[model samples]
Target: MQGATRTPAYAGRGGSRSIIALAGTLITVFIVNSLIGLFAIQYAGDADVRDQTTLARLSHALDTAREAQVAFKIQVQEWKNVLLRGGDAKDYDRYLASFEEQERRVRDRLEALAAAAGDLGLDAAAMQAALADHATLAARYRDGLALFDRTHPASVAVVDRAVRGIDRPMDEAIDALAEAARARAAAIRADLEAARAERYRTLRTVAIASMLVGIALVGAILVRTSVRRA
Candidate 1:
């Protein structure tokens, strides 16, 4: 009549409750969604870490296998030295001891490689077979050295001819295992990268969604305040 009609006291409380409700709902949605996004990203990060660990282990195993090959070559070289210079007892004993030591090193490395490969779910059967063949070849070398009568140095030639290329198959097997390991590492790296990218994309999407919702909520609050003032 004289001016605007008076608002009931309960009406102001009701309006306040409405603003509170609206803010609470939007805030809750924003917080809950952000928490979920963080948890999801953490899970993805854990998975990526596990994959990287696997790749590292495989790489170490491959290195162990290669080292085993190098030790085997050294063992073979010692065997050759034993043949050439072993006419003397002292030289023969030293060369034979060196040969035996290198053989032990090779075996140890291969054993480590096998264990690592098996743990990583790789097939080590071919490498194991190669190791067995190496044992046979080593035995022949031992026998050849034993037969070296202080009189017959030419018998080394007979032993050499017999075991000339016995290592070819084992060499091939090691190469195959290395190739397989490389392929697996590549696949793991690719998968890890993809997972990282996906994680980033999901996080970006959540951030964008939250920002938009916040902007809308601010706009709504400003409008409601203006309406209340009016």
Candidate 2:
């Protein structure tokens, strides 16, 4: 009789220990799941923030690149006007001044684009080379203008021949740079969209998983209580 009573006590102790161990396991899983959820949320937020900041930067760089192209185009037109109206001293001076001003604008924009490219991890070498080429081209324009026979008709041809096609390389370089910036922007925009979708899915999945884990934990505790009462 004594041994039988002692066996029951031992069995009760084993049952209590089993219940405690199971409860501990559930709590540990819950904590781990909660931590994982927190980590996922943090990761998503950080990625989204980085994407937004990068997109904004890319947009600015693209705008600067486009503006640089426009400025360079206007500069070229002004150069042509200088040759076309070289007979009129006033017009020549005005257009030449405008040409220089536009050149300066182009330089500023290109430099800005280069800096932005560097920040955004794009190829800035082209912008740098373009700047150097633009400087050389400006100097050539001035030198070419020295051959201008303002008193002679068809003297514009002389200036054109001197400066003709010299700008082609620089123009191509600038266009290529602009396209690069545009492509980078497009890629980032796409990544941002994908990341946003992924974040949503992650959040939804985590929420569901956490809810299920919580429900399971509660159910386990209720069953444990009933077992103890029984």
Candidate 3:
């Protein structure tokens, strides 16, 4: 009679359950990692958008500040014209009108700068300081203009004195405000960079963990297959 054929033993229910558990764990880990990666990517994109918006606002604020400064200087020129050549009623009226026009432009741009700063979530301290300086300067300018309207020749010394005291200080304050805005922009850029770095770090960690999990699952599968074959 032929010898009875030998048969391999089954891995049994416990082994089957272990393999299922490992497969389930691997799938769950993969899904979780994918979701985490997607979230990180979206967060990074949002951060980039915020950074771009902030930079644009900063540019607008700086431009407004510069334009306001130019308008202020034009107002000073108009004052000089009124004090020097405004003896005639026509010349005096023309210069005064020009001064008023430039003043309005300056005030408008200053307000725009303040709005931009507020939108960017920046402290409006510098802008407020500049505005206060502008107010003080405007008061002095009006005083000089009043003196000139009544007596043009007598207005020369008064206007010159106010220009030295008020105009120069106002210009300096505007310069300071512009510098502060630039500094704030730099800080925002730095913050964005830091956030990006953190995002990358998290992604790296996730990638490493995923790789380790894959290795472990693969090793466990190989061992089980070998035992089954044996």
Compute each candidate's TM-score over C-alphas: 0.80, 0.78, 0.76
Best by TM-score: 1
Worst 10 residues of 3 by lDDT: 5-14
lDDT of each: 0.76, 0.84, 0.76
lDDT of 3 by residue, 107-167 (tens): 7887788777777665677677777777777887777666554454766776677566567
lDDT tens digits by residue: candidate 1, 1-230: 88989988977886887788678867776787778678877877787788778778878876777787778778878888888888899998899899999898887876786676677666678657767877877787766666666568777787777667776776676667667666766776787788778877877887777777777776787687667757
Clashes counted in candidate 1 amount to 0
Stretches of candidate 3 exceeding 4 Å from the true structure: 9-30, 85-94, 114-126, 149-158, 161-164
Give the C-alpha miss distance for residue 137 in model 3, angstroms: 1.8
- Candidate with top lDDT is 2
Q: After superposition, how far is residue 148 of candidate 2 from its true place, in Å?
A: 1.5
Total backbone collisions, model 3? 0
State the lDDT of candidate 2 residue by residue for 2-107, as single tens digits.
Answer: 5564446766786787688777867887787788888887988898788878888888899999998898899999998988886898998899899999999999
In model 2, the clashing pairs are none
Q: Candidate 1: where are CA atoms >4 Å away?
A: 8-10, 206-230
Give the candidate order by descending TM-score.
1, 2, 3
lDDT of 2 at 29: 74
Per-residue lDDT, model 1, residue 99, is: 92
